[model samples]
Target: MNLDELRTIMRQCGVEDGVDLDGDILDLEWQELGYDSLAVLEITTAVQHAARTPLLEEEVALLTTPRLLLERLGTLTPAAV
Candidate 1:
């Protein structure tokens, strides 16, 4: 999905309301954003559903940032990009 959709998913998944995630956010680890394993699972599952793709749980677990997740999703489902 697009950046706005990614950000909205993050927010809905409990990211702080107005954290002002700048460009630097792309390099930050998912854990740094306060997402536990469960949160990641939920977010990735949501993304998979939204993108209409079948994302492996192991693949999602390997993603360390939103950019990485987006990139992976894009690779898995071109329509998502």
Candidate 2:
């Protein structure tokens, strides 16, 4: 559910290539990130394994970026501004 955990899951899912996890996942083009529907499914699967929670379909929509995904997974706590 954390950034590190999300990154690890994404690496396992083979969607991290040519993608930048430092910023946001949703900000990038899905095609550019090498994601098709299948890849997204794979990511969702890995995310479930990593987060130990079976995400709802709607949750996937919220998982647009690594940051967003991590936020959805409750992995990333908001830091003080």
Q: TM-scores of the models, in the given order? A: 0.78, 0.66
Q: What lDDT does each candidate get? A: 0.75, 0.65
* Candidate 2 wrong stretches, greater than 4 Å: 15-17, 20-32, 78-81
lDDT of 2 by residue, 1-81 (tens): 666666566566675456675555544544567777777778778878766888888778756655566666666654411
Tell me the lDDT of model 1 at 45: 85
Worst 10 residues of 2 by lDDT: 72-81
